[model samples]
Target: MKGISYARYGGPEVLEYGELPDPKVGPDAVLVKVRAAAVNPVDWKCREGHLDGILDAVFPVVPGWDVSGVVVQPGVSVTEFTAGDEVIGYVREDFLSRGTFAEYVAAPVRTLARKPRNLSFEEAAGLPLVGLTAYQVLVKALQVKRGETVLVHAAAGGVGSVAVQLARHFGARVIGTASEGNHDFVRGLGCEPVEYGDGLAERVRGLAPEGVDAVFDTVGGEALKISADLLAPEGRLASIADGDVVGYGGRYYWVRPDAEDLLRLTELAEEGVVSVHLSQTFPLERAADAHRLNQEGRTRGKIVVTVEWEVEPAG
Candidate 1:
């Protein structure tokens, strides 16, 4: 199978496109013919050795997590899906040994979910990691209730775009920070768009007047440091982008793939309660280009790598 791999941690230039042996599935796993895979900051972060301490990689590591595909084969013990089923999932971090930047990848049946019927392969590919992160933060970590107000930083980025929409779906009046160009876009997600940088607090205050009930900070820098002041008394704050979140009195959520959550997101997508917006896509061989665009941090939504031959026939 053809895939992209890096022998060592470095820049995008280090990635190479080549052939590798096909993956072998375990009794509880399924072999996915990857149709499209999404890129996250973590992909490049691992590429550049930023996650060296937390995640050790073997040489020639395949780097991708979010995937949407068709099941080409199912493990002996897998009962949830068959060879032609459409699925989406976050391949385990431990399995970076064989990542989604390949023609095929194997995942535990427990990590995979039926892809949303309403989404295309490219759009479904954009949902797993970012969608799960947003769902966990709002529904699990912060327990945001209806009629409250929440603020999301970096609202135009991959995770932020989904987070803003999900928060609003849960009945929170959402305020999101983005550049002027994405103001109308964020507003379309039912959020009040706040221009980020320089007096963000004042701008938010001018819009809400009563302050926000929670803060979801995807741009963790000085913004994370100042986020506490924007919250109402005892309000929660969750940062999915790992940074120094020590004093914020809220949890730092590192995303993990939960089949249950992915299933729920699928239901939401099918119901038109939430949507996945794919900003761009590259062929599997051009994994370097996908990483380069994501690392630039200007993407309005998810960037995906499409493995064209793996796409399933339309239902």
Candidate 2:
């Protein structure tokens, strides 16, 4: 099998692409022949040792969590899916040795969900992490309701883009912050677009004279601070990027692998209620280049790395 791996903590330069042994399927796992994998900031962050204290990293680590693929083998205990089932997974294991940026991944059954029929492999690949992040923040963490006004930081981004649409589906009025250039794109996703940076708080005030009902902060740091300040008296706040949010009466969340939550996202995609926006894609060999693009931090939507393989017909 071909995949990307790094022997040590570093930047994209540490990534090497070549043949490696295929992953092993466990009693509760399914081996997926990856059709596509999505790159998130955490991929590089983990590679550079930023997540070392939190996640156990086995050097020569394959790095990625989001995958849309076909199940080629199922574990003895797995009955939720079978060989040839098309699935999507946020395949985060307890350790970082084996990952989705490969031709195959042994994904635990708890992390696998049927891929949305309306999405191509490339699109489905982008949804697991970001879609789950958005869904968790809005529906689980914030509990946003109909008729509420919510503010989403970095609204045109991977998680934020999906969050914007989900907020609308929940019947919340959304105000999303993006650059002036992506304002229209944000608007098309059902958000009242507001330009990010310096005067963000004042601009948000202009949109909602009263504070917003909730704030979903994807871009952290000062944006998290701003989100804390802009919330209504009873407003909820959650940040996926900033742990500092805990100091501001807000919760910090890390996306967890849950097949049921992912299935909800699949339902939303099937209903045309939310869509994964693919901004760029690379062949599996150019994963280092994919990391470079994601590190630039200017992408409007998800960046995916695609794999091509022959799927044996279902018997």
Clashing pairs in 2: none
In candidate 1, residue 55 scores what lDDT?
Answer: 79
Q: Model 1: clashing residue pairs?
A: none
Best by lDDT: 2
Superposed Cα deviation of residue 5, candidate 1 (Å): 0.6
Q: Could you list the CA RMSD of all candidates, in the order they appear?
A: 2.0, 1.4
TM-score of each: 0.96, 0.98
lDDT of 1 by residue, 5-113 (tens): 9998899999999988899999999999898999999999999998888877887898888899999999999999999899999886553467888989988877789
Candidate 1 deviates by what RMSD?
Answer: 2.0
Give a tens-digit lDDT track for model 2, residues 1-315: 999999999999999999988888999999999999999999999999998888998878999999999999999999999998999999998888989999999999999899999999999999999999999889889999999999998899999999999999999999999999999999999999998778989999999989999999888899888888899899999999889999999999998998999999999999999998999999999999999999999999999999977666999
